[model samples]
Target: MVAQDEALTRRLSRRRLIGTAAMATAGLAVAAACGGKETSSNPGAGRSAGKEEKPRKGGTLIGAQVSDVNMGTGYPFVLLAENPFLNYLPVEPLVRYRNSLEPEMVLAERLEYNADRTKAVITLKPGLTFHNGAPVTPEDYFFGIDLILNPRKYGITGSFQLAGFARFITDMKKVDARTMEFTFDRPRANMTDLFAQLPVVHAASYEDVKNGKAVAGTGPYIFKEWAPGQRLVFTANPNWHLTDREGGPYLDGVEVRFFADQDAMGLAYEAGGLDLILDAPATLAKRYRARTRVGPKRGLVYAGLNVTSPLLRDSRVRRALFLAVDRERFVNELGEGFGTVTVQPWPSSSPAFNPALEASFYDPEKAKQLLKEAGFSQSRPLVIEHRTTQTYVNIASVLKENFEAIGVRAELKGTEATAFLAKLRAREFQDVWVTAHAFSDLTPVTNFQQTFPYQVPNPSFYENPTYLDIIEKLSGIDPLSDEAKRQYERFTQLWLTDPWLLPLQPTVPVALLGAKVRGFDEYFLAPGGSPNFGTIWKAP
Candidate 1:
């Protein structure tokens, strides 16, 4: 899914089958040493570039962020806002991704697929213990899987990812104490992409975890403290199994300071109070050019139309709304020229990306005509609610202007980050909402099944049998094959006709690192583009 060279493509394709565990393990080490395509303005930001320096240990790495880590239900399954804190830091997944975006073993010692790929086996690494000092077992992994798939019973957000997994995995069985077998409905390739999303939890402490009373994981860090709306702290795990970096995490601990907004976070980083800033604003990027590292454009910013609404149910109205938005303006102004106007969710690197469909959808006059035909005009404008969060207020404002230009009345409703995300996940919005979503950088199946806007029976409430059938067929075929491309084209055409989710632009991921921060390439290049504190170190 990512932009890969010939070598990377061969390696990924070869490693997707059985008997390549040793090769995959070696690739992980190589990726760790070489990093990915993360480009820093400064010449000497990564290990393989400029002059290399030995990483110093025993210092706290302080990171500042505007969004508070909302540990909703204390489960790291659906809520992506908790990823930097929960996934792969304290709670480890069966596999971890390298900078090249290949899966590497974490809790899983071996992953094997049978011929035709309908069956698979996962062997857990032995002698693993949770942060609570309890042995890590196959049951714990199963418990986490069950909890995610049955979101209603767990009181957590229902995940499209688990639904995608359910489509392939018809049954699962515990083969032994350290191994589990999976039976799929059909042949499946690139199984690691699915496994990488599941983070195992200690079943014994799950009740406490769900209640927010305790935290237990088998990762490189142990959860220490969390002050709501202020900060979160984690100490190193001395016995972390991965010995690639001299046996354990380089930092003694990590402290994440929460700010009300990006400005506040940038100020803290400028004053030397914080060592890193995720998704740094353009102002900070310019001021600290040398210290900033720019990653791939992996997130899609789009408008999710609520098709259940009476007005939005009309195909004409949805098409008009999509046409009214100025995608170029949003890219140049809101994104500060750090994004590309896209007609679809997939990036240019993806096999699903079609250059023929990149034509602009912005047509104010056509939008006006469509609105008038749909029984709305300047005399009696169509009123709609526009839901958004603080981060997208400016984008919403621009959209409001765009809609008004087409003789439509738009009302902006802004909510906090946590509440906004909850509403999006629950499909609680009345009209339409604008938000950015990740997972476009992964496999096309993951993008369809993981992102809220792209999920089946999505928040938009728009459904078509043909579109569903195409997606189902696409899931079972080779992603790089001609048939897969034809399916993607058919699906894209169907989506354009309905226009449920209005495509906007793709934004680049940028982070500001302090002069002393080292080994952050993996964090920036990781899947989902969230920070992984395991390899990070603070220079003394």
Candidate 2:
């Protein structure tokens, strides 16, 4: 295990070096294109050199979102992918990830872990202030941590998402004005990775934030206006600390208009009404290849089986359902071949990702035989109520046909995003639920500890002592260690034998930028593909 850990560290270091070199080379290319001139300090000076453009400061970027930003109770703590602006623009996590997947400090200037990894000291960047003009101190971090760790007291839905920390963090206190300390119940190998997901906010503004009266953060943008179902507006933070580029966060403001769906957003983009489409529909990838920036596979579309349901209680029935679906078809048709068919949730870059299991679970004939062995037949067909949001209704439809082909009757039910999420959180789905989940790329442990479908007391209501033990052990060991890999493989084998969540394919996040949009590629590097408007600028 020690050897494996050392080797993995070496490989990751090499990968980070390569990624850094590539980015440096790209920066040089951009500099050469612009005649090696510095970006203008003047917000209005939009310049170009030899047909290549440089980042300009003054523009109100018009971005489009497929759905309204649902600022649920606890506001930014809910961490919904649909509400990207709330996650990144108005609030910032302590740590963010670069393209190399290495931690980049945001609010935190340094994090030191004890030898046993059971204690941590976090030092905030000095002089950081929230948008409300209050200093960002250790108390603010404690406030946010309290809200997450004691969700019942705050009536929020975030504790379950950070179960690892929620279960292990025994005590937290302020060490100093700019420093905080955390004591864990056990050693946690992925402490920094977990911190990358936690966003800190001003504690004094809790009531205002809860009531939707105001929002404040130490990020690069200040929340200005939110027009319910129509649009939300933000202005650049003039006092932002990061100063990597001249007049950085060059856009003066950003306006995010909410559309009914992707098609409407695409039409708006074509008509020059929008400057950016954060997650363009896969079907439009080819049409906008030149303008689109593709990122690594960060999420997976999976079917969750409710083990409590009689129709799916049998392991044979569940395994049959897994084998009946054609994941490749979902990739080619729904994903437009922009994704890879995967039997497990981990991304290709993850140490837990097993090449042997890639696309190895499809066999219609075997699926039919398994269904027969489980007493399912045309005369006595197994019926399943599959619930999902409209965004994933297409995949659910395909699943219906696939199940029927294997002698199972599948009923499809689609609901609004809010209603679907409510049901999902409540674990009220009858038999099956299909949806896409992120966080599979952060750290292998995150998928099991954070994702709703994979976490303990999961939405599927499927529990095995062995699986629980494996995940518990996984949390305490180095994620890239051979022991961790073996545990993940064991978990995968057990899941296959008694399948609950059927992973279909991993979806690569693709963002389309307008011809004049620049610096938006930085969005792909942040955790969970959250858009970093701070680095994005217009080409004038």
Candidate 3:
């Protein structure tokens, strides 16, 4: 009934699935040798380009967190954990990412998968301890998962990630104090990646963590102090397992100062008060490129349309609305030339990106014709509601003009972060709202999973049983296999055919580091999200 992708044009590449169990096994020796220094998969492979400066640790790194607020307790809360700005510092997961952004052991020493791929044996690194001096055990990991799945006791009622994880996972058992086994209800295509990303919490103090009394994590940085709404401080954990030349957490401490405004953060960065600004403006980033490190964020900034709305229910009207807006102009205005125009939800760098899918060109005349055919006239023009942040208010204004030129009246509805998310989940928009969502990881499956209602329900209300069926088939299949490729191709087609969200552009976030900051590229990266400043050091 809705648009779908064309027949299989090409198969999914094997390179996308290179990090298999065998590859992970091979990385064990290398991981062990580095002492969790976050070395690339290969030995003797260093990411630093210039003359390797030996890391000298001492001073505290004062930086700005991308998010205005942290949950205070990031572990076991799906909403809190999803934002990397909140957890990367205080909450350490079992699977730490490498310089290449590949999942490797941090807390866990070995990850072994069964031949059937339905079960996994995770052997934790021995003698690991939490920030509160609690010895981390397999019981703690299981308890954390349990708390996340059933978090009524923890104050959080429910979450999509928690519900989805509970639905797939069958059981988790402690083999010994250091070893644990996981049995999945169904084999997962990205099992290791998924498990590695989960942040472990101390079972002994789950209630304290749940009640916002204390944060008991095994991360490099310990929760030292919090001023709330102003500044949060973290001291290097003395008992942290991960180590480098300077022992652990190259910096003695990290101070993440929160700013409600980006301009204020930029001022702080320029004044040399802050060490790093992970979400610096494009202009500021360009001005400070010598001191800044830029990377592809692999995220989407788009407008999610309400397909259930009577005015938007028609496919013709939806297509007309997409054609009416100038995505390039919006990117230039809002993203400041640091963004690329995107047609589908997948970024250009993504494996799921379809080059064959023709870009939707802005055609006002054609948009008007389509709208006219849908029975809208001057007396009864199509009314649209656009909700977004003050940051993109200008882009929304331009979008309003674009729509108005095509005989559509657009109204801007701006809201804060929390309210915006609540609106998105409730589908409380009149027509469409300008918003964004990111991939939990680099996998194409995550893109589909986030959009699909079953896995991780998106703001868009569009649903199809056929699309769901194809995604189910993709589960546990080899990424390079013809079956997985076919499923991906089929799903891509379906996504194109039924565009619930309009993909505007790919965001290339800039991380502007001060002169004193070292290991910006080496240790302060989280593949698709914010940088992890665990091993970052300030020049002595």
Candidate 4:
């Protein structure tokens, strides 16, 4: 399943677990019944989101993860999309989302906009310092933007979003040590959300970061050791803003252990080797959902058709592929009713979600007709490649079976994550590939831009200038105006008609937590299944 990028690392696995209070099941039920009114925090918040237990001080929490931290640039380089759960703990953003998903002041005390809303002036919070004892400065903020916009020797993603900001914001100037001003070429919506996701680091430490040496930030944790494929260790930042009296990180330190198998991670958790299991198999998650926290994730698992490929170039073929697949069956059998069928990227919670879009019929006869009209037959079967995870392999198998029912022969190709990403970026594929793409920002513009044609290599070579223009126009639309509503509905229609990629379902990620752990907030689930470990403590 996909995790929210703005929050934590998104785990690809289906199931995971974390801790909860004695009344977790009842609380979760109440929260769900209320439409998440009380549990508005995003997924991966652990059990702390709804519990009232007073936090105590001092304990070490151990977590088991499936991926290794070999990237070495997990700190301040989360844009590279590696080890964000580890990297983001030591570094913080200027602003962050509260439980309401609203922008909350963090390092930046206040953010203001000009009359036209084209410029933003920010004032930093006083008395903030990096873990290395260096006071935070406006130069550090500018440096963070530069690192993302014009990255040098940094393995990063999100360049598109950063580049867009730099393109629209004509200039940036530091006013003082703790203040700065940004002038935009045009009015932009969701400015705080965009800036809140950038990782800030001290400018003086850029060289150290380039040399693979870790630098401390103003976050609650201090980097101690990153043992690559084994485990990562972090200690409490003594000089952090949140003091013990303020309910600051009650843990003395935190450890993240890496395991190759989900079963092994579960075993470690069951044997008390791990305090939390962020992701696990569905069967295992079923046992702990009542005791631990469980909820639906805000991401979608979809199939991206290679628009450039000969087999999938025809619109009819793409439509046929979408029509042939039984999304409801996939959700029922593969997802085991844990997920909801998705025809588009937006989750049901988002205003952009279209109810009518889900009514598309599963017509095998129509799919066969489209394939025949597109000049395809069993002799020339369509072949698609996907990542080789067991869960994804099973999903692909279900899709293959559905395609066969329509007299359309389909071949499934499985590969590792690294290889799959490399090939995808290179635009090397036959028909389509499965991916769990989720947007950290809830804005519809981001949903369109990321999937729209840009210079960078994306899964779908869906280059349409008109669609791009509409996306830009939507960005400036007044949220509550009739025009904005019209634009939203128009975008929905465009998405249903063209559908650059086919969304199968919104993944429901599970977490497993040990009974001793406390202050595990269910809102901690970021784009990745990772949580803010600093808020959590252990009971005596």
Provide TM-scores for the models.
0.86, 0.87, 0.83, 0.82
How good is model 1 by TM-score? 0.86
User: By the lDDT metric, which is better: model 1 or model 3?
Assistant: 1
lDDT of 2 by residue, 373-473 (tens): 78854434343333333447777888888888877876777777777777777888888887878877666676788788888878899788888988888
lDDT of 1 by residue, 246-334 (tens): 34588998888888877777777778898877677766776777777766656577788888877677777777888888988877667
Cα error of candidate 3 at position 217, Å: 0.9
**TM-score between model 2 and native:** 0.87
* CA shift of 141, model 1, Å: 0.8
Q: Pick the winner on lDDT between candidates 2 and 3.
A: 2
TM-score: the better of candidates 1 and 4:
1
Question: CA shift at 6, candidate 4, in angstroms?
Answer: 38
Which 10 residues in a row give candidate 2 its minimum summed lDDT? 28-37
* Stretches > 4 Å off in candidate 4: 1-53, 70-84, 152-161, 207-215, 243-246, 358-361, 377-381, 425-430, 450-457, 524-532
Poorest stretch of ten by lDDT in candidate 3? 26-35
Strongest candidate by TM-score: 2
> All candidates' lDDT scores?
0.68, 0.70, 0.60, 0.61
lDDT score, candidate 3, position 300: 64
